[model samples]
Target: MNEALVRATIPQDLVKVLGVEPRTDSQAEAFTRSFLKNGIQPNSRTDLNSMLSHKAVVLGYARPKKDKSKTKSKRAKGLNARQKRAMKIFHIKPEHQRYELFLPLHELWRQYIIDLCNGLKPSCSPQFVQQKLLKADFHGAILTVIRSKCPSHVGTTGILVQEFKHIFKIITKEDRLKVIPKRNSVFAVEVNGFVSHIYGSRFEQRASERSAKKFKTRGTIDL
Candidate 1:
């Protein structure tokens, strides 16, 4: 069946519903002439729907119109350049790094750890204490480097000011900030007479990551 015949066979009601104007004999003849001139065949059977769709595309009605109000712009993930630069510029001032200023913070941390360890009861299982301490936040806790590869870091006690992935920044009793690497270092904290030792080498993770991570127990750990 020819395209012209197919168009002619379409019902009048469908042509009205599709909002299409029926092509007259003169228009069809002109279209056939144009197709032949362009080296195309007009013998293919094209349905009314296909014809209307083609007409819509030619008139630019088929392309979807974007509504700015309905389309939401996606927020970029993580810190931007400005935030990174600002972080570099803003740091704890030396004058404000007094250990006395963080005494209240240390008290709060002591209370928090005591509560986290279920009051640090004598009957509490070692496994439970270990699990809680593994995920515990050490910010504001008084950490004393009991043992370390660096002899100078040994016995250095201070309030933990900040914790990084591989470093611990602490404000010493002398009101100085000491950057202690977590590699091959051991820190101890006493809470209500219950002393807990933190092996830094095994805890080389951010607080957020340590909270979610599962640690496997080995017979021996290096350092």
Candidate 2:
């Protein structure tokens, strides 16, 4: 074959073998010059074969890098302003606030207390019972306001409905939903004939918050 034909054919084969198609003539010429610089002559059949026998070196453009700072990660935002406003606006109707309506809830609460106190056996320590009561879920409990700073709040009995950060919403036997402030009030509950008193003054926390909190026993509280 002619030397010019051999040179042209070698570069074409190099393009195929290397899997790189040079976009411009300058790039193609540069690739050909680099190949020729490797000292492999393409004029003779043996030299051409030797040149083709060598391992092919590929060329490619690098992939574009991604920017991590531009990427947005989702985060949880609990109870938005709209939801908080809606909660305050919507409340249980007076007609729906009946004592019989929450009897099932009270029963469930009684069973929950029983299981929590491990059947409230006589062998159970007073300290253990007290601890359990402090962390107890009182939504279904029969609560009676035995003592309160407000005279009108005293002797109020109801089934607890919603427990907030500083208040207990209870549905009374008169089909009335009463919002009792936890501050300066004392409530009583009976579990399996064992009566327990709760000092509402110190119990001013959400039920969820109370569950994970540790309380220190006080000798005497003037309430």
TM-score against truth, every candidate: 0.67, 0.67
Error of 2 at 73 (Å): 3.6
Q: Which stretches of candidate 2 lie over 4 Å from their true place?
A: 1-71, 74-76, 87-90, 217-223
lDDT (10s digit) by residue, model 1, range 1-223: 7878856556887988888887788997687656544543457555544554464423235668899876786775888758977887436887898999999999999899889998989999667777788888999999999999999999999999889899999999999999999999999988788777899988899899988987776454332
Residue 214 displacement in candidate 2 (angstroms): 2.3
Span of 10 residues, lowest total lDDT, candidate 2: 43-52
lDDT (Cα atoms) of all candidates against the true structure: 0.82, 0.83
lDDT, residue 85, candidate 1: 72
Between which residue pairs do clashes occur in model 2?
A: none
lDDT of 2 at 37: 55
Q: What is the lDDT of residue 34 in candidate 2?
A: 72
Clashes of each: 0, 0
